[model samples]
Target: MRLDGARVLVAGATGVLGGALTAELAGRGARPALAGRDPARLARAAEAHPGAPTAVFDAYDPASCARAVHDAAAALGGLDAVVTAFGTVAFGRAAEVGDEVAEHLSAVNALAPAAFLRAALTVMGPGSVIAAFTGVVAEHPQAGMADYSASKAALSAWLRAVRREARGSGIRVLEARPGHLETGFADRPVAGTAPPLPPGGDPRRVVAALADAMEADAELLRTAPDGTPVVERRAR
Candidate 1:
């Protein structure tokens, strides 16, 4: 899964983490096709890359997810890797969280990644990779963010199942459970107020760690709060 000259599609490419990832990919010699719901932001991100393609897609819509993957593959000539950095978070007690916010979190954080992974697999083959930026909350839940935590937990479970299914197929599935990063993610909650959280990891460092893991075809990449590589478990 060497990124050099690899054709990669980065969904949610306009976000804080996504933007950093796209830049890192380009620097590593990979061709990255940026995809997001906001056309203007996507355009801006694409412009920065100078000839990098962009696609607009609603993460909640299955058709749009599939189409975005298709467009990215077409734009890049082929798909060697796909990184789904799209997600939304809502902060509230489980009982206090409204159904609308809960549903949106499920759609964006869980189902969207599933849709993107399915679509990417359609265009990818042996030696290809699919990675998602899930969080440590998915594994260790905390108070006031049950809905957000559950959504990521669902994605983690699905990725584990998909990884088992894709075994021996040369398609690597990576789940990156990075600790909180100071990427203004807490400030952008879809609903409710985020509690004061501990200092977060560095977005750039997390992206670099993920890039290295993908190149080595590692399976699980867990990072510390400062974006240091804490654990890396390769497939047996």
Candidate 2:
């Protein structure tokens, strides 16, 4: 679990939380490979962190996801930790949201990470840590966030099942559910779907907690400002 010189891959590297997390991982002596859908943004991040590997990946494409993981592991010589941080929130009533948008959001939010984790575990040996970020809304439903919440909830469910399967493999599976963060996600364009989050959410704290949990090999329920877990361990 020690991050010192650990080889790590962070998906959604251009995203608000992902950006902060990449920095934190690098600071901890982990060689972080950046992956995103945007070539320009990926190039920028790579330029900012010279010697770091970059991979172009679309979360919806399982082939691309597998390839990226393979290449990143190769580039870094080996992979120790893989962080699946790709996310999308489409704000609206579930019925009001179009089918296409709903499917896309679901794919990005839930299916993407699920597929990524599967691919990662296939190639990743023991002592590898896999971290995926879910949302607080997965636990507490919101009227305008029905689709978003369901997608995150599905992701949480998927992680829990995988955790049980991977328990004996010595491969750690972690789920981090962070609440409203100040990272301007509320302002960006998410394919004309949900709006970004409001300001004042601390990205640093979320990333810090995630880092600590990963290093300590602890399963966590990361929260927002109020210290409430939007996500928790599901009851048997």
Candidate 3:
């Protein structure tokens, strides 16, 4: 799982966290294929690292997810790592949240990543890694973000099961539960308005932590609110 010269595909490359990750991966000497819904943004992200490939796909669409993975793998010749940073947050009280918002959140946060991973495994081989950036809200629910929390929780559960199932295959699965980062993610809620909240951790620090975990083949990497390293769990 060495970042140097690793063939990686990063979904949601246009988003704040994903952008940081893509840049960091490039800086670490990894060949990254940037994928996202916006072709323009994906192109821009790829421009940061000359010769990097770009793929366009809607995260909520299973077919698109599969196609994106296939295209990225083809572009890279083979994939050593696939990182899913695609996510949307919805803020609302559980009781007042509409069904549409809940469904959208689930589709983007849970179902989309599942689809991407499934497709990625088809092309990925042993020694490859699949990492998902699921925030701390997945493990600890937060008020006003019930739907968002539930969606991430579902993804976390799926990742745990997949990790157990993939144990014998030599393919690593990592789940990162980083605390809030100053990526402006909270301000871009897909549904309800965001309430006032404290500034988050440094995005660069969070990306570096994830890169370190991938290099060490860790199972879980958790960071504190201030981007301080908290814990790195290895597969037992």
Candidate 4:
């Protein structure tokens, strides 16, 4: 989809990566409507782009996720893209993590994004793009992050299926499954401490690559083993 003047709604605009992406999208001439769980942070995030619309949603409430999408669509007059860049993380052995933590991870990481994109589909037409950030853990689950990985994998699987269904309508589903990023995400896990990790890939480069992928109508964006961003034109 064309970024120039495209009306885009970025869920999780309050996050580090999300904030950077919102800035990048705005710089590329896309009009961005910011959405987050916090009204105050949402307001602060919108300050970067004066008059950019903002919506609030609670990830735990699926209805709020859909409402955020509709609210942004209405505020923007229409939407050309909807991107979900928010998720929660937990670090613990599969057996040690509590059911409550597992539920929270699934709600925020999987169901919430699905809710946002499902709502976007009704308002968006052909040529509109829908994207989400699913991490490498989705495909390569780590021992300490079982539930987190499962949640991401679930979303990834859902996206894969929806891509096939949406293909005939010309809607693009871009799944960004990049490796660990230098965004301090691991340091803020909701459960057990993060294990020793190598230096992370550059998130800014990933952000730029994501914009390129969207413009090129690419289906996947991932990080190479050497920390470089790579875009796959067609997803296998």
Clashing pairs in 2: 91-194, 181-201, 182-201, 185-196, 185-197, 186-196, 186-197
**Which numbered prediction scores highest in lDDT against the true structure?**
4
| Runs of candidate 2 exceeding 4 Å displacement | 189-200, 224-236
Question: Which candidate has the top score in TM-score?
Answer: 4
As for model 4, its CA RMSD to the true structure in angstroms is 0.7
lDDT of each residue in 44-107, candidate 1, tens digit only = 8888788887889886688898888898888888899999998988998899999999999999
Q: After superposition, how far is residue 226 of candidate 3 from its true place, in Å?
A: 3.6
Better of 2 and 4 by TM-score: 4
What are the lDDT figures for the candidates, one per model?
0.88, 0.80, 0.87, 0.94
In terms of TM-score, which candidate is stronger, 2 or 3? Answer: 3
TM-score of each: 0.97, 0.91, 0.96, 0.99
Looking at model 4, residue 191 earns an lDDT score of 87
- Model 2 quality (TM-score): 0.91
Model 2 sits at a Cα RMSD from the real structure of 2.7
Task: Sum up the clashes in candidate 2.
Answer: 7
**lDDT, candidate 2, 151-223, per-residue tens:** 8899888888888898899898888877777776755535445454444546787787788778877765577
How do the residues 1-236 of candidate 3 rate in per-residue lDDT, one tens digit apiece?
88999999999999988989988988899999988998887887777878888888886679998898898888889899999998988888999999999999999999998999988878888889999988889889999998899999999999899999898989999998888888888888887888887777888888888888888888997776566855476733
